[model samples]
Target chain A: MNATREELSEKGKKRRDFITLTATAMGGVLAGSIAWPLLQSMNPAADTLAESITEVNLAPILSGAALTVIWQGKPVFIRHRTQQEIAEAEDAPMSALPDPQTDKSRVLKPQWLIVTGICTHLGCVPLGQKKTEPRGEYGGWFCPCHGSHYDTSGRIRKGPAPTNMIVPPYTFVKEDLIRIGESS
Target chain B: MAKQSQNPYRHPFVRWIEHRLPIISFFEHTLKHYQVPKNLSFLWTGGFIAGFMLVVMIITGILLAMHYIPHPDHAFDSVERIMREVNFGWLIRYLHANGASLFFLVVYMHMFRSIYYGSYKSPRELLWIIGMIIFLIMMATAFLGYVLPWGQMSYWGATVITNLFTAIPWVGDSILEWLLGAPYVGAPALNKFFALHYLLPFLMFLMVFIHVWALHTNGSNNPTGVEPKTAEDTIPFHPYYTVKDLLSITAFMVIFAFFIFFAPNFFGEPENYIPADPMVTPAHIVPEWYFLPFYAILRAIPDKLGGFVAMISSILVLFALPWIDRSKVRSLTFRPISRALFWVFILDVIILGWAGAKPAEGNYIIIGQFATAYYFIHFLILVPLVSRFEKPSGLPESLSAYYKNSCHD
Candidate 1:
């Protein structure tokens, strides 16, 4: 007697296809999940690299001058304002500021305005001083939006801004240069 | 007698719940009768990819939180420690960080897919609206979570964003204080953000469930943009859609893994590694890449309140899309003018994202304002105007006709 061939119905074929596709997809997901951690393990050095403080050269910056640099992928605005700017900032009328006394409490050092350049009023990079214009009554930088003003010392002076420009901590290595990452 | 003898292994409560609820029957009904488009291709995978990314974020986030400290003093160091000491900690942190970017990428594509295919029209309106809510919540969750690191970008980014509320007329400062939990973005703010960030995802998960439910309720919009008219136009969701969605998700995972593994920091800001200091400010304080397009919009207008409104309305307009589009026909395939307008909208969005990344000056701001205007016009004016009068090409009577025509050719 001849053997009979069993024909698979369309429904059975579809079921098989569904199971196969699902298994393949799930297998891909599982593979990706496993691979991510493994790849992370291979880059053990990046962890150390990520945490280490970077050394920035401040030699090019003049006293009472500000320059911006990228550290760890964010913009670090380093302003080396001269003693004159600092003194003028201190002498500026207290009534002109939202909070005066140059708020020495906010700065790590009185000289450098180490702030994240982002505006406190919605994260825009406020325009730098316009061509030899003295830092205004608030004395430091001015945010164009809503006219929030920060003193040369990075304190909030006038306008709708809520807080002082962030003063990142730093110690001067020499008269002309400063290191941003480390402090004495 | 045999029938009366119940198996003790089968719990009486299980039987009672099953009989009362008949939840299994509902599953059977969904499986057997829920119609899905058989012609759904790989593009359909974006929704599922977004769903998968959400799950990844929640899982990795929970794990990272176990080791993370909310206190400002400990938070930065704790993140460092996780990177250096904890087993698989670096992996978890990177995945969560990069997963956020991936999630946005997939969602943007999903949103774009909806736009291109007119998936927001008519019956699918609620689904698209629910998806929009998910998008907004995701944005908030991402923003809040970004602040938890207490890094430079985190600190400055938080400061800048939290202060935007003060632009509101009256009660603005009060609202800002309420959000920060203190006068500024400091320890209290970070702690509150951490708490809220942890909580919002659970809420998002619930919203996602609603999004999916709304989607299933209306059924998925397909590439054809043509609504199904008869039984022959659709197939079972189980085998057809399930397979298609799964396949695309797998493909997306491949690309996603490539980024997670090979170049994790490619998209990240380098300055974020520095611990935040209140006194020092960073130059060019830009937001994360995902926020650039809207950021550009915010800057496009010179006026504070005007810019803010325009930026926000850019997103809010998406919710009004179903009503904005006045096309009689559903699909863009038939509408030549609408199709061209769609491409213009895509270009405008890309330009906006690009302009957002650049410094707000010169021609960039000008371009951004123009793009912003067009962005609003695309939905507010172009969609309604062009869709109404623009002539569309021929459309097939049914999915079967479309399928047969393609097969014949």
Candidate 2:
């Protein structure tokens, strides 16, 4: 024992022990506190949060076509699912999904397939919204940045994206109109 | 024991190449197998953040340079064209610009971490010196990069900074002429700045290599500021530090991305958006936020040459710190007085930066002068006096004992 450690009595030693232990714990927690906001700040800021809701007219989107709409600065894909596409998504085997989710679980309605266009691997928007863009092997959205493939239900069928494309919290107000950002 | 391994690489192709070049083993020895103190704090990740920012800056800077025009007439337009015309150029520009601030932020954290732990003392002095050299190069690179935009702040800021050399005694003007390569801060100066901006990062990279070599030689100072005594006290760099660094880097990238996407011009002056105007200087000219503390130090002095010298001396004072501190113990955890004063020094620097942000007038000048004086006093006077008179009696015997709270069996 050194001078201070030597001078302390049994009680003082225990108190000192507690102090050091707390200090170490606090130091770790405080270090954690510094990095907390670094990650948190990446989450949507006030302006993005403020401009959260977006209204999309579903009337213009044809039976097979997908329309991309901006909601809170992220692309939301609203595809008017063709009957054949709906069947493919619903009948697709659970074993094939890299990130498995049933078509019933993914959609609020069978006719409209609404999912965020951003790839789960990175934030790149997958390119199946337009006719010219290749929809990858699964005949769904393809991310050109990487080669992530999503099915008609926006399930991750292949590549780096670990999860299914998110079904953003949205609700159908009118029969032909959908509102995004407000809870369903 | 030092003899080379005949089959360091398991793969036949790798082994064949290793026989000639030996890079695989070099990677293993220097990085993969390199040992570091296991008790290193999250604060230690500051170096990793700095390295990450350097790569970001260099990659973005190279892309910026490809489209950048050196001539003053075209420079501003070229930068505008890059933003408007070139794809993802805005992202690259914002990242490079903001990356400089974050780079300095992390480097300062790294430096302060060293100071707080007394990692600069004794055996690690040269390691600290090499780090300072890297910091100096970083500052130079940042200064040159700021000039490339050829905006109002860019031209006037360059003019003001280059004019500082004119504060030198008989050969001041000659020095200025040599530096500018012209009578005024014009095409020649901008070209030189562009060329040097491209070059300095490579120099900083060399210094960083030497700094790492020195670091590996000295090893790392732990939170307890105690050297490792046994194998248990240290771990291989690959698994522990590599993962630790990635976590910190990911966390840091969030903030970096937040700035790039959300607040691209947060650290930038609005005046810099206006193209270069030599005739009309911005009413309240300020250097980038990273340079503010030194800029405050420069203006604090009444005399031109004195301010310049004092500004330079502010950095030089850090070079003498390992010697100036007379304490036997390294960590401020044991030295309560130094710990308290260390914080006070940080507050003082922040105040100086605040003063620098404001126009140098009245109360700001008075406060800045006091802060500047306190800055030197903290290093030269208070540290030595307090460290000598006060005893750090409860100094821990070993890293394991203090941190692990029990001696290893």
Candidate 3:
């Protein structure tokens, strides 16, 4: 451990440093070139990427009723918020929630509340998409897998979930039609 | 240099090339004359066996990959065809699959050897850390490879694991979507997993190279935990250790061959032979046998994120082991308290693995919770506290002294 090699002369050391730096730069270039193609392969296939956007008719969903639709194989909750339901979501104290988001900010229209049904905790589908299931303390979704409570605005209210449910990229095309996956 | 000139092994053409490349001299310096502590036990041979297992795995994996179709619809069918139709495909497939189990078994034994000898402490810290990294990547590689057969367990296991990521705060869903490449485990998930599974083993190969480099840097810690003081206490690696390692590898191969020829499905789930159907999850969606201990830790916790953190931390905590037990002695042979604790820790892990395979109900949960607690406590508290109070046995002066005193004991 104590043995030392013969020290390099000044010019020799400079040449060694130059070679090391040059070799490093060449290695970086080679790595990037190889990585680019490999990374590109990981992107979604064209057929699957095309299915990323889905259109749903709003006429079938009655007011206060939430309909579950499949977009990119995930359950998208499209709720036709009734006047009362809208007021209930709007009147809730935003500052008191774990993840604070105003009811208006989540939806393009006051009558619609569309969010991904997947829970923010462990990705299980929350149970309140159906009228028969428990809607938690808040009149929204409750994930039975883990006790995550979400408010009507889809903001996480209580439990281990750290944030609100995801709202997929969506836009309202007409009063009776909406599209999920492509944002306005 | 003068002695080598007289050796017949150095051919005239080779000597001519050696002047230009010095490749032969590199091998002579690194392998032939490399000095190792003379007292290393049969346990020390596990590393060599593991290296041989890696080569076996890579060759068999490449052969299996030649016929494997990564699509969800065809993966199970393709594996079946390889087993039934392709020439000697069953041998290659069994060797690769069973090789994975043997690899894990060898690695675990090697790891326990290190822990028992306190090989993770002090100057060897970085070496141990690199080993832990290799283990982490090995687990990831095995997990992804397990999914390639596209069985019922494969689909649900992928589902369960990928979903565990969603327990993360804000970016969970996006990460899950990106990982799956679709909303759920499908063709894209299978394709990317296959690519990553194929890729990680090469990374492991590079890591093994660095691991050896680090090992040679510090030489080796022997069973006596005493450093060699003179050339008399050491031997050249060329013939002594090489023969020892070769004998151990031959013994390992016999076991490996037996499994391949006689009991190909011994370590595997029968449900895995069934094609993956997302509609029907197998009653027990357990991972491979080797993953059971960590899986038990994950299920021990009731909270989703907590379980995720616990499962991950169980492995990550080993990275801290070099600093955790501030002991002067290197081997458990001298440390009475720690030696007892080490065996208890081993028993706890085995129990945890058993608990993991069983349903998480009634007594299994109780057993799991206790074992999980003991695991953390063993590392965090028992190790440090025991080192402080327990008086270690007297270490001999040298390797020669220890050999002479063996009969006296």
Highest lDDT model number: 3
Model 2, range A1-184, lDDT digits (tens) per residue? 5646556677787998999999999999999998888645433334433646899899988999988887654568899999999999999999988778899988888989999876654345677887787788888887653356789999988764557999999888999888998778
Runs in model 1 deviating more than 4 A are: A1-120, A123-184, B1-17, B406-409
Task: Assess each prediction's global lDDT (C-alpha) against the native.
Answer: 0.76, 0.83, 0.85
Highest DockQ scorer: 3
Per-residue CA lDDT of model 2 for B115-191, tens digit only, reads 99999998999999889889988988899889989998888778778777866778976676667765457776788
* lDDT digits (tens) for residues B311-384 of candidate 3: 99899889999788888888888898899999999999999999999875658877998999999999889987
Give the count of colliding residue pairs in each prediction: 34, 0, 0
Ranking by lDDT: 3, 2, 1
Candidate 1 lDDT over residue span B1-409, tens digit each: 4422432226677656556675654665576578877666676788888888999999999999999999889999999999999999988988999999989998998888888888889888888888899899999999999888888888878877787787787877667766765545667678878988999989989998888778778787776777788887789977776777788877888887887889888778888899987645455567888898898888787655677788789899899989888886777877888888888888988999898878656688789889988988888887888887887777777766877877842
TM-score to true structure, per model: 0.72, 0.68, 0.77
Which of the two candidates, 2 or 3, achieves a greater lDDT against the reference?
A: 3
Error of 2 at B378 (Å): 1.0
What's the C-alpha lDDT at position B217 in model 1? 85
In candidate 1, what are the lDDT values of residues A1-184, reduced to their tens digit?
2433444466577899999999999999999999988654423234323433546677777675677775443456777777877786677776766555454665556666677665556644555543364344555666643345676766676654555666555566776456655655
Error of 2 at A114 (Å): 73
Worst 10 residues of 3 chain B by lDDT: B2-11
